[model samples]
Target: MIQPIFVYGQHILEQPCTDIQLESPQLQNLVNNLWDTMRNAQGCGLSAPQIGLPYNVFVIDSQNAFQAIGKGFRKRYFDAEDKGIQGIFINPQLLEVSSKMWKAEEGCLSLPSLIKGVSRPWQIKISYYNEQLEYRIQEFSGLTARMILHELDHTNGILLINHMGLLIKKYLYFKLKSIKKGRVKVSYPISTR
Candidate 1:
């Protein structure tokens, strides 16, 4: 199912999610929903919280972003059998985010019709349980890393708005207000509650 994104001003976006059992049928459904919602929105990632589930789970498929990484993206990450490196990451814990920072204009399904400049680490190291309950530690860079960091923030109840300074927030006040009031037009479905 293509689940609706829980937009800004929603309490779920502010409340940290809890980890769940690895083998639950509901967890499988949530993962499927995340993938579907992300693809429908043309987004590189989606978190459980974004779909109104307070579970520490997120799905990332930045490898699908052919333009961002060029046409050879699959070649870079795919194996001989064409199995690409991307999927649901559960119970994610940020092991480290590099001190080096990169600034970019980021858009979120949670903050539709809006794009904000935010600074994030250029690289990250994280540990998490995969959908198969396999514990893994991984490092990533480029937009892949940025997307993971962004989705990881969702699991911790942190919004991209929280990363902005007061001045920027003030500058975007009207746009943000429009979103909260459900007046902004978004291509994808969103829930402000």
Candidate 2:
């Protein structure tokens, strides 16, 4: 069964995730649940903290979504399709990021009723272990890059609202209140209206 995702302003999203050791069955279960939650929500990615689990675990299905977005860095290192965009990332460490930035609208499974415009690095090189505990280095650019950065932020207990300007932060506070009061459902594109 898919677990209930924690909503916006939850304390779990503010706490850093613990690193996952490859040999642990607990890590495996977290990976499985994250994937299931992402697919169930039609989300391109998910982090363990979104489900009230504080572990450095996330899953991404970048290939299909990348194709859907119509553009991506073509010097491919991993099979966009075969990678299934559904692999587990454990103890992820973003080694480097490009100076360039890209603005995109981001949504979270945890904050299912909201979306927001945020800027993130346009490219990044990340190192992480797979479910089997094998180390892998992956380079991502454009949309995939943004998704990875967003999930990484979740692992570190950061939220898109935290990156927004002060005015935007104020707007989000009220918007979040409205959400809690059942005044809205699924704030599309950007929630800070």
Candidate 3:
């Protein structure tokens, strides 16, 4: 079943998530629900904290239509396949990052309407354990890199709002109020404050 994705400014996104035990069924459920919620919301990735789960699990699907554009060269190099709507990561750890940085508009599933221009590394190499507890290392670039970094931030209790300046934060604060009143189609998650 799809779970409710917690809105932005929730305390959960600021607290580090616990690492998952490879053999735990609770970890499996977290992976499942993250994927379900990501797909249901048409998101390219989701983290456990976004759904109020405090586990280091996240779902990524790079094959979505939006990712196809501006990613042709990257696709050829990564050989990304249609992984059937979900790639689950458990206890993911960032190993290294390239010096290249890319600026892009970033949004959070937890913060629906909050889109901001943020700069992130263009590529990263990450090591993580899969469902069967086997360790794997993969290189991600471009949009995939951005998605990975965003989800990983959730595991570490970071949010895109943290990157926003004071003016932007104030803007979102008032916008969040309108969302709470149902006056707008919420673009970011409803603030818990």
Candidate 4:
């Protein structure tokens, strides 16, 4: 079932999420809901906190974002093996990050109509459990790494706005206020509590 995303200003969005038990009965359902809600909202990634759940989980399907770009674009930044990854990350940890950095504009499901430039490591080493409850440590780079870092921030109670400088936040003050007031417009469902 598709769940309504909890928008910015919701207290849950600010609180850090808790780790999930591998044996939790509702784990599968939660992962499914994350995927369903993300796809419904046409977002490449969705975190458990986005749906009012405080579990340390997130789902990503970078293929959808890749499909939107042209072949030339893909060839420039991606390798032949970079078809994209689709999976659920549970109890994830950012093991390491490369010194190299990349900056890009990112929009979040919890912050509709807001896009901001954020800088993140160009590559990252992460340890996480898949939906099957299998643990794995892997390295990711390019757009995949960017998406992972964005969702990871959610699990840590961090928002894209936190990356903004004082000036940018001042400029977006009213817009953020509107979102917190539940006045922003979006195609998918949203909850402000």
Clash totals for all models, in order? Answer: 0, 2, 8, 0
* TM-scores for every predicted model: 0.87, 0.82, 0.83, 0.96
Output the number of the TM-score-best candidate.
4
RMSD of each: 3.7, 5.0, 3.7, 1.2
Can you write out model 4's per-residue Cα lDDT over 111-131, one digit (the tens) per residue? 998888778887899999987
How would the candidate models be sorted by lDDT, starting from the highest?
Answer: 4, 1, 3, 2
Q: Write the per-residue lDDT of candidate 3 for residues 96-128, one digit (tens) a residue.
A: 998988787887666666788889887789998
Q: For candidate 2, lDDT tens digit of each residue in 29-87?
A: 78887777777777888899888889888888876664554334433322343332555
Q: Name the 10 consecutive residues with the lowest summed lDDT in model 1.
A: 76-85
TM-score for model 3?
0.83
lDDT of each: 0.82, 0.73, 0.75, 0.89
Which candidate wins on lDDT? 4
What's model 1's overall lDDT?
A: 0.82
| Evaluation by TM-score, superior candidate among 3 and 4 | 4
Give the per-residue lDDT digits (tens) of candidate 1, residues 31-115: 9999999999888889998999999999988656633554565454323343334778999888988988878778888888677
Candidate that beats the other on TM-score, 1 or 3, i.e. the better one: 1
